[model samples]
Target: MVTPPSYESRQFERRPGIRPRQTLGRRLDAASRAALPAAIAVVLLLLLHAPLGLPAQPALLLGAELACVFYWSLFLPRVMPSPVVFVLGLLVDLLGTGPLGLSVVLLLIAHVAGIAWRQALMRQGALVIWLVFAGVAALCCLIEWLATMLLEWRLLPPGSAALQFGFALGEYLVLSGPFAWCMRVVARPHG
Candidate 1:
């Protein structure tokens, strides 16, 4: 013979005196996941401004921020919408002493390109992906240089832009691995 569990044992209910509490972590978890990508972009942007003894000043791969935007845009376009991209660009502009809207425009362009290339990038090899990124970075650096010169009304040295492009490519090479890992962890199905 088998014994059935009592009703009280199987049917526990909260009394009026008991109330649900929302911890900070729980509250944050309740937020939409869409913010995750933008948050990462902000963190990466902050790291760029931090005193890491790395040459962030004077155009030492300003593409760090762009890299973050491009990576997320390419992999998970839905999570990172245009408004988030716009905010990230504003953050970059505020973090450094540069033209305010320059990053906004550049990041928006990267976002668009990444979205357009997402399908192709899915089937490409690592080298091809890196080459595509190199092209995007170069375009960003060139635009940045041209904008700076246009704003200042002077012919800024081209060498600086060239150096920035090289450093951007290097930044992509170093950061892409970690970015990919983060994407897997964050974007995985929550089942």
Candidate 2:
């Protein structure tokens, strides 16, 4: 007859609390992943306010913010949480000349829209994504304009808002490629 090992010897619970430690590279990777969203937001802010002599309207800036939030939310929702989105929008509001909470609300809406449509959108091609983004940008601009009008208690001209919308949509096309590349570099998982 062969002797069997004791229960205590075989039980993993009996061992010391020697959990597997992550390697330094893995730790750094996780830290970078966590910081990436804010970093991207900051970069977008810088680009939005860069002294390029181009007029940086609230709509255009929000569109840039939308690109960041939208890309991250679609690709890495776990990294771009609601709180992060809110903070980024708040920072944009503080840094730019926009109504307080305007960026916050619009960005949050864009973030949520990204999350909601991510699955369907991800399956589609690049052109479809841009089309969808155009629709979201339009809706966000409309809501922003309406909110400003309601809060200010004055009828702002629709022409300027419409112009902003067109500029924002155009700007998105100009910026989306770089934004997507950044998203890939930041959100890519490490082995």
Instruction: State the lDDT of candidate 1 residue by residue for 78-163, as single tens digits.
Output: 67889988988888888778899998999998899889999899899888878988889889999999999999999988998898
* TM-score versus the correct structure, for each prediction: 0.78, 0.79
Residue pairs with clashing backbones, model 2:
none
Tens digit of lDDT per residue, candidate 2, span 100-134? 99889988988998899988998998888888888
Cα-lDDT of candidate 1: 0.78
Span of 10 residues, lowest total lDDT, candidate 2: 5-14
Give residue 166's lDDT in candidate 1 (0 to 100): 86
Which regions of candidate 1 are displaced past 4 Å? 1-33, 56-58, 189-191
